[model samples]
Target: MDEERNGTGTHLSDAQLFALAAPAAGEPEALPAHLSLCRDCARALREWKAAVGAVGEADAGELARRSPEEWRAREDETLEAIRKAGSHRHSIPAWRWALAAAASLVVAVLVLTARRTAPPVAAVAAHATPAVAASSDMSAADAADDRLLRDASYLAGGGDVDSGSGLESRL
Candidate 1:
């Protein structure tokens, strides 16, 4: 079937021939004309139809031979195999749990270190305001933006906003 066609007219591929075998409603306009004119295509269509019919007969024969109990037992075995495979697949490894714990510990340590290093936000704001107000070049908006940035950093480090002595302790 794969060999180069030695004849004159173009022939239908295997897929087109199969589609013509079990056509949807009124078959394609050109198919009937092609099948009538092309002997090779007609033969291929017949072969595909025969193969389909043979498969249907085999399925029917198999259903008639197999008892309901035998079918149920096969289904049960397949389900048990799936369940066993799923159980092992769903469980996390010990090393993965250990890795997660280690990551959590590292995060906790970093949080504690930042909290210890940062001075209280009140002292910082007090010293910052005087310096910002004295700067002749600094606009009120720029001073406000600077204060917001410093406050954000202080909050991120978990420092107490109302505690600590003054700028001297921070320095």
Candidate 2:
């Protein structure tokens, strides 16, 4: 960056001056290149940086010391503000949309992969029901459950399991 404005000591164009002096002031990029190397521009940049810092410090000083919960709330509020800012803002880079899209695709793939690779459910029920169905005239759905409980109770009580209950015999 040439420091001198053409070495003519003439004032620079307004865009050139702004780009050098107040870069954070949203100056567009088509400014004069010489202004970048100017000592005056360097000084102006430092001044603006200092001014912005002081203002930030003053704003921070206005707040009181907060409790832990208040600190958490403030943290949440700051994060929420940042979230709202990232979501709806137009002044920043346009590439953010591409980044967000990429992240969403990654998340979608991860969810799909997890679903695809997840463990299969046990097949204990399928084999048992059909085999029991062919062997017994009893509706295996109801009778098998009754048989299981009766067998478990008989085993637990150290007694012989009866072949047929009075209800089944009557049926």
Candidate 3:
């Protein structure tokens, strides 16, 4: 039925037919051009209109006959059911808490174990000092080379070499 209505598939949608059949304000809706061209859509629209009419015709005398006290009791019962549903609590099971605690304990033990097995920070820093000293010594050598180049340039330009301290003495 759905395939016949929409999948094969050039007919009007069920919603469009329903809207034409049951206009909300009880006014007749304008028919689409497709409805005049398509027999299936016309039949579907008639079916929808009949269904809507049947629903509208259903007797409401039972509800109309209900006393005010009966309606109040029904309302009270509905409210009590809603209150009971809202008040019910959902609790975490005990095994879930136990599992969570176990996982936390495992993580804590792993962290403590790793800390105990690793080298201390003071010892690591002590081992790193010799490498740092070596780098500083290399920089000092580079500074000495730069000073020699500057002095050689000054001498080549006929500047007084005797004005500054002797190169050997500075070295």
Candidate 4:
């Protein structure tokens, strides 16, 4: 690829043609010596320059066709937008901070009150059903599996199988 690009015999690549067509701002690129000798590359560069010029001219023509009123409205809208952007508040309002602090305090108070009012774990466990009490002696995995199976069975409308209650009684 390097040889193909640098070879004086070969035509300029599309990228090289574009660079020649639109040189970088404040930085002029030296034209390849081959471009002067190669009519095909020179013509391609001219075509690229024409295309780039057409793109810029198209937008200018569109703007030129706009009515004076439309131009003024567009200018006003742009200025208003710039003004609003510049005037944007960077700091939060005092009321917002106060409200947030109050909200946090309320939530903390509610959490603490709930904790105080709730029954202790031992008391709750004491009131649990025989199955729940029995699970206390089982391994964690076994207990989790047991709970899942119980939930599934309950959801399926099948009451506890070990409760001595027949399906007829449940129905």
Best by lDDT: 3
lDDT of 2 at 47: 65
lDDT of 4 by residue, 65-106 (tens): 789999999999999998787666433366678999999999
Model 1 worst lDDT run, 10 consecutive residues: 162-171
Off by over 4 Å in 4: 1-8, 64-171
Residue by residue across 18-105, what tens digits does model 1's lDDT show?
6777666756435567677777777888898897777777889877578899999999999999999987676657667899999999
Cα lDDT tens digits, model 2, 32-140, are 5544666666555556557666776677863644568888998999999999997767645567778888999999999999878865445546756775675577676
Give the 10-residue window scoring lowest on summed lDDT in candidate 2: 162-171
Give lDDT tens digits, candidate 3, residues 11-67: 877788888998978898899887877778889999999988776656565775689
TM per model?
0.31, 0.24, 0.31, 0.32
Q: Indicate whether candidate 2 or candidate 4 has the larger lDDT.
A: 4
lDDT of residue 89 for candidate 2 = 76
In angstroms, the error of model 2 at 131 is 73
TM-score of 1: 0.31
Candidate 1: residue 2 Cα off by (Å): 2.4
Question: Which candidate would rank higher by lDDT, 2 or 3?
Answer: 3
1 versus 2: better TM-score goes to:
1
Q: Compute the lDDT for candidate 3.
A: 0.78
